[model samples]
Target chain A: MASTDINSTVETVFRIEQARLIAGLTRMLRDVGLAEELAQDALVTALSEWPASGVPDNPGAWLLAVAKRRAIDRLRRAKMQERKHAEIGRDLDEDRGDDVERRDAALDDDIGDDLLNLIFIACHPVLSPEARAALTLRLIAGLTISEIARAFLSTEPTIAQRITRAKKVLQESGVAYEAPRGEARVLRLASVLEVIYLIFNEGYAATAGDDLVRADLCGEARRLGRILIGVAPDEPEAFGLLALMEIQASRLKARVGADGEAIPLPEQNRAQWDRLLIRRGLEALARAEALGGADGAYALQAAIAACHAHTGRAEDTDWAHIARLYDRLGQIVPSPVIELNRAVAHSMAFGPEAGLALLAPLETEATLRGYLPLYAAKGDFLFRAGRYAEARAAFDKAAGLSRNTAERNFLLKRAAACGPARPVMR
Target chain B: MRVMVMVKATKDSEQGVMPSTELLEAMGKYNEELVKAGIMLSGDGLKPSSQGKRIAFDGPKRSVIDGPFAETRELVAGYWIWEVRDMAEAVEWAKRCPNPMPGPSELEIRPFYEMADFGEAATPEIAERFDRLREDAKKR
Candidate 1:
């Protein structure tokens, strides 16, 4: 690589591995903010040294090594006498300037498994869902505040403040920098799973912007799920989450056209399905089931994914089973979204009226008041039932609520199909 | 052990928005449960930050600063002091407290010190006496 190319590549690698580096540093420093600052200091050292030293074989290890050395120097500078009591790990007997090798080894080994623990700590429910999601993307995914802000259609300062408050909340709660066990584990685990799911959904269906898929988000979310799988192999919900993501992600290649337009699932080319990912997803589902079927929310969702994976054609799907699974899911966790989904399955299984009956009750719900999918689903059922006027109104409402160019276009097309709501400025 | 359950305050809570009238009745019942179980020592709400002051001392100088501190994040609007056997028991009580900030709030359970906390040979610098003095003065 050319010199400048190599320099930029170093920057990119550091950014990619930023979370692992911070996780390592946070363990050593015990302060998330300070750990990040120290990690940045290491990045600064790299920008100045890599060109001169020609980039180390393992750049991540090199950054970790540099940060560790800096940490010891920092501790010494902060008043050695105070840290002396805490320095049972340190050979304070040796000259303070000497024994750099000892400090590096001590610092490096203690933080090897810390990154995953940091993810759990960051995702603790002590913070709001927004805060937990933002913090996870920052600490585990290694995303910049601006990068995160851009992904969510939010301002940079707002994202920054959200992250700041999240860290502060965890600290004030004394939530600890370690993973929980027993019932406490279950409480915090739900929040952690939700954050990862949100990250994946953002990738699977970009909330805003012209593009139908933001593949970068998919890669980040997948990486996070993979990490969770490794960290909590026996936790069935974790496996279920990873499995669901894998199966869903398996369809990504065919979800968009060459022109970057959205491709509805039925119309997409199945030949483009990633067989390897599908296999992995199937295996994860098996693992989740093997672990047990009274599975947590994520595992139940995985079972739903498996039904889709096993089908050869969209029309051949066992909608009856899907409806049953949705019913089971509703009983397990009552949510308006789940009810909406169950209604769709009911339509597919029985008839449009079956679905409409389920959906009509949700029409007056405060939670579903502004949700686009509620209108979209209602419109679909009405159109299939041959109520063109009702379908047109529902579709128009969906189109108004939706901001995604592709989604809005799709809904408008459905509205136009009812014949008479010819395309206008709306 | 006397565990002090610190209910982190919010702007709405401090405005005498004492839960809803319905929630107040639910809370009265919950407090009854606490009393029946013999855990509730004391519990009540505080006035808004508009009626509060933050005092800072540097050497002999004292700056008494005055509240709706509008700093929603820092306000500790109310608390319930409970004498619990251990941390686990304290958590159980906190779980039962009527959701203090139905809109946006949290309850923090912290352990309080007893008189025997300052036993023989305790260093003056790190003494419980100084800590107790700071705690008493702050509440005043």
Candidate 2:
């Protein structure tokens, strides 16, 4: 192979194996930062040797073996240094020997558990959300500092420091290199899922950035979700989360216009939706439901997305079914946003009056005070009800509250559609 | 993006020779890795071409041909649909796959055409027509 080809090949192999190697090493060494360093050391070794010998048959195992040997060497050197400084070095020798024996045993243990433990540690709730995302992408996804920075639209140095501080915090906190069990396991898994969804949302709809959709972030989140489901196969919520991401990702291409303007769901061209992803998502949703997680938070949302996906056109949507889902979803996790959605669903399923009745109570909601979607829904309902003056006022209010340039323009267009009011005929 | 990875047929495969136990085991492990990485959407190995039939159309004329077809190398023994970040990632994963057959073998990766690829041609009317066709086919 040419030099450049060999370099890229080695890099690809490294990317594939780095996560497992680091996870296994972290379990053995109980230090994530050091484990990552040893994984890199193994990659360097491969780069130097693989070109001469050709790629190994079992490259992943070869990388793991190399990383393990380096880890053992590092431990021995550290032990030797401690022995030199200590007056009572006799006991230390036996301790070192016992440690080596234990490390040897750990080598034969399941790598899946190690990977799961690494995920939990990286996504531990003690870390800040930003830190969790940065660390998880760096460790689990095998993404470099710069790659993560580019994904999140942050400065490279900022991301680097965030990751460094995150590692230091994990070490200082002395988080166990083991997956939690029982109730603790449930909470920790929730934290992991939350981080994954947060990453997906940041990509699906950038809250603060100019780019509305960052496909890379969504892809990473989906990858992470799949990994989570793989390791925790019995967890239905994992399947639910994966299903939700897949279905939502299916619409990514249809969600924007040529100028990158936001295209609301109703207006989006359904042809652009990714059918394969939708199929995968529906299958996953079925799995989640079969696992008796139909009532689960993520599963409920996935069901809603599936409703949209199952329909060929927006007007053909089974809004009554969606409204019932929102009713159930609202019961489980009450939110003003859910109420707003329920209103829109009711509007579609019944008439504009039904939606207006639902939206009336939400007007005093502190959280929904300036929420753009609320007014947008109200204006839509009012316009359909032939209350042009009220619809114009509501749309104007919605347009004023809009953040995205595309969304503001769309709302302004709606407001303008409601022309001057004429006197009512007696 | 998604790609269909086809394991090209060789002489042994065309003759209905089953994979050795070791090869099967290696492929199993490779598939598990793909699933865990959230790449493999669907995959299956096909029986030898002898059991398959093809139809040819020339204007209004229709002709039927039975397999085993000629040009064994062009025939597919198996295929997988994988969702990957890009073609490079797909290629990397494909490179990691075990040799699909005994002796020299080949794998081909072809990306599926995405809806965006159709540009303005993929109108709602066309999409709905395709949807109806799909539903009709499924019903049949």
Candidate 3:
């Protein structure tokens, strides 16, 4: 590749690798800020050098090796300081090479509490869940503010401000860099898990863009979950959250077609489902269950996923069990979205009337006013019940409200299936 | 008395790889040194860009995207919250540290805004609610 190509490649890869690099650098520099600076220096080196050197086989490791050297240089300079002159002069008298060797040794310590702590720090309670999510996505996930904004059908400036303000608040509040433990950790873990899930959900059901899902987002969330498992192994909710993500992510491959069209859950091919993720999700679920996640929101969501995972086809789904789980989830974390999901399950468990009845109350909810899924789910129930005119109107409204191209297409198709619109009811 | 060190991440540091064992120890020692020196109030590193995401809001609508971002110069990789007497002390400590990056790195030190700085502009309700806001975050 030409130097230009090499530079571009380095930049692209850097986004993917930034978190790992910062994690590594923070250990050597002992300053989160310093570690980030060192990591940037590594990028600058690559930008200047890689054009001619070509990308290294292990580009990340190469950058890390380069960053650690810079840390050593600082140590040497500090050793020569006036305050350290007496001790440093004596130490320098022994061997200057020893200093280099020691610095090298210090740069490579590997038990990784720093990276784990970094997660908690990024997901700190000082910011809103959205703010924390944005910051984590920007700082830890290496996502651009615009890309994050696009994922949620949101605007770039708002996301950018959220991230900037979140950092400012964290700075102002004197939040610690280490992970919280004991009772405090419960709060921290919930935020962390929510951030991860939010990231995954965006990928799994992208709010905007042409595609229905962003596989990269799903993959990244799973990666974070696995890391969280290592960090907070005993936290059942952590495991539950991971399990939920893993199981849900397993369907990504089958959720769309070769043509990039949306494939509803009932229509998805189980054969395309990732068995590995299923296994992992089940394992994580087992851990959550063992740790007593019976009442946890994530665990309940995981249980709901399990219901889907256990069945071979959509027809085989245990809707009654899913309805119960949704009910439980709603009780713990009451939200319009949870209710919407439960209504779907109720429709599946009983019949269209049951689902429509469940959804009837949500019509008055202000928050669900612009929510497309509500109309789509209600439309599905109405369609099944041979209420074509009403279903057609719902689907049309869903098509109008949805931002996802694939989802919009699906809703439009459903509307078309419902036949001609003739003074349809709202 | 408190200052924050903002470290910018370049597109290069985010690789899906672990640092060598030696590097990890070196980092721990460096943190230990900072702690021993009393310059570090607290510090920690972040995960690679691949591990995070961003959420952009355009009014009530939200958008998200995966990371390992493109811009290196403007990106914030991590931060250190330090307790120091003043900017001079913060700079002095920053200068004493090893170079942050493998090639070369820069550290940007910024002071935290004091509550008093807000003066009468910030309502008491806003100030009191700040803590409550944080606690609310914990619940979500």
DockQ for the candidate 1 complex?
Answer: 0.01
Q: Model 2 scores what on Cα lDDT?
A: 0.84
Per-residue CA lDDT of model 1 for A211-253, tens digit only, reads 3224456656766776776655667887788788878888875
Positional deviation of residue A134's Cα in model 3 after best superposition, in angstroms: 5.2
Which 10-residue window of candidate 3 chain B scores lowest in summed lDDT?
B130-139
Rank list by lDDT? 2, 1, 3
Best-to-worst ranking by TM-score: 2, 1, 3
Candidate 3 docking quality: incorrect, acceptable, medium or high: incorrect
Which tens-of-lDDT digit does each residue in B1-140 have in candidate 1?
56778778776866756567877788888777564333454678787777888888999999988854666767788878664445655665565567766786688888865323643445455434434543453454
Where in model 2 is the C-alpha error above 4 Å?
Answer: A80-112, A206-213, A421-426, B55-64, B86-88, B113-140
lDDT of 3: 0.72
TM-score of chain B of each: 0.77, 0.88, 0.75
What is the TM-score of each predicted model, taking all chains together?
0.63, 0.86, 0.58
- Error of model 2, residue A287, in angstroms: 1.3
Residue by residue across A26-98, what tens digits does model 2's lDDT show?
A: 7667789998999999999999999999889888889977887786677777774564434223322222236
Which candidate leads the pack in lDDT? 2
Candidate 2's TM-score on the B chain: 0.88
Q: Identify the superior model by DockQ, candidate 1 or candidate 3.
A: 3
lDDT of 3 by residue, B1-140 (tens): 45888766654446533545666677677666455333454566676677889998999999998886766656666688775544755665565455555545667898977433655666466534543543443444
